[model samples]
Target: MIHPLNFDSLLFGYPVGKINVDQSWDEQGFLEEAKTFQLVYIFSQSELKYSSETVRLVDIKATFFKRLDQSADGCSSLERPNGELDQRLVKLAFESGAYSRFKVDERLDNEEFEKLYRLWIQKAWENREILSLPEKEGMVTVSIDGDSGKIGLLAVHPDSRGKGWGKKLVKAAEMQAKREGAQGLYIPTQLDNLPACHLYQSTGYTLSQKEYIYHYWRN
Candidate 1:
């Protein structure tokens, strides 16, 4: 049995003792390994499946891709909007923008949220760009891999939702991707996040695939 790092913090119960592995491994062999540990958890991302006594599907994720047709005037990371709001509120809004749905995100403590904020801000500054409205309504950070022009981390404030701010941010991301000569853009969203999925689809992103997250464990 192999012990893998849980970067996404998927360990549900025992963060320190639990271990996550691929679903394709020998189940019985791994089950035997679990007997040696205090308690173990096997977590994986796959297509939807029926839950069993040992294996249970936990979360569903959807993938989307976009192909830019024409060149769009792109913006840089330095062009972030200065909403002039309270710093704490801005931080909260940005942190919650793209990650509120992920189960792991819900586990983030104050320190973790701060780390994520700094990490995301740094990533945008180093390699990607941010599209922001600077208002109480709009806030997002889009990370782009310059070599591949893959756009990532699209976020919008909940208050800014339903007013087309997300669509606008996506458009900005697409333009930036095209400017960077990327093939297109790709993003994965939770199946339950209907508005986000809808915004991506409405912005010319096509459904790429469906995936699920499962956690198998025993006491």
Candidate 2:
């Protein structure tokens, strides 16, 4: 079945929908149903070999999870911003999504991607939930629900790539989650983004699951 994605439609100025189907789904039937929407996103547990019409956007999304040490103290170096959003943070947020499906789909307008990330950083900052290094060279956002936590957006400046800022940001997120009484934290990155995968693995996160994401555009 196809579900209309109202937010996506509004963001992209076109009809957008999503389909959640297993490997057993009939390809012809799925394509026929998907044609109703201008763009349809299909998510599956296993990689799907589809006709040329369907574009495999993200090969594998590897989600890494780590159990927090509630006894450990949270990081004190990260600070929450006050007042207007920082343009630097906006750029960092955009950099963080370089491997996102939106960026991978060449059909999508590049300006839209920038606008999307701009709004993302703006909202995260306005919500006052964003954390950043004292130097403001990187930032990370975390969302908590009961005993669980998830890192939303993480990015380090291009000039500071190899300086271990990303790892520090991850550690800060863990500490923030622990302070909020979260027992564990989860973060997802595209499998092809080896740098991110390596960073998470080195920071004590383990692979939790892998999924396939495909984009079907009906022009």
Candidate 3:
């Protein structure tokens, strides 16, 4: 069945919908239904065979998780942003989403991709949940729900890639999560994004889940 995505439709200024299908789904019928929306997101546990019109946006979505049994290091160096959002932070946010499906789908305008990340950072900052490491090298946004915590966005500037800022920001997020009484933290990234996957793996996070994501754009 197809479900309309209200927020996504509003954000992109067009009709958007999503379909969660299993291996037994009807491909021809799915395509017919997909054509009703401007954009349709297809999610599946295993890959699905589709016509050329459907684009495989993410081959694998890898999610990592780390328990918060022990206190995390590198918290001292992280600072919460005050007042206006830093332009550098906005740049970092945009860089963090370079591998996102929004950027990968050529159908979406480049300006919309930038606007999406920009507003993401702005909302995180306004909520005062953003943590920035020293010198604006990297930043992470952490949020808590019940006993779980999530890393909303984590980014390290391209110029500071090799300096271990990404790991530090991750540690800072963990520390923040522990302080908020969360039992564990979850971070999700595209499997094709090797650098992010490596960073999370090297920082004590283990692979928790994997799924396939596809996009069907109405012509």
TM-score of each: 0.65, 0.94, 0.94
**Tens-digit lDDT track for model 3 on 50-150?**
76656565547899999988747666888998878899999989888988888888887736688788889999999888999778888999999999999
Superposed model 3: Cα runs more than 4 Å off: none
Cα deviation in Å at residue 121, candidate 1? 4.7
Q: Find the candidate with the highest lDDT and give its number.
A: 3
- The lowest-lDDT stretch of 10 consecutive residues in candidate 1 is 8-17
lDDT of 1 by residue, 111-155 (tens): 444554555555554442655555534445555466345445565
User: Candidate 3, after superposition: displacement of residue 169 in Å?
Assistant: 0.7
Clashing pairs in 3: none
- What is the C-alpha lDDT profile of model 2 across 62-163, one tens digit per residue? 899999885544457789988788888888898889898888788776466787888888888887769997777889998888999999899988878898
The 0-to-1 C-alpha lDDT of every candidate, in the order given, reads: 0.55, 0.84, 0.85
Backbone collision tally, model 3? 0
User: What is the lDDT, from 0 to 100, of the residue 199 in candidate 1?
Assistant: 83
Q: What residue pairs are clashing in model 2?
A: none
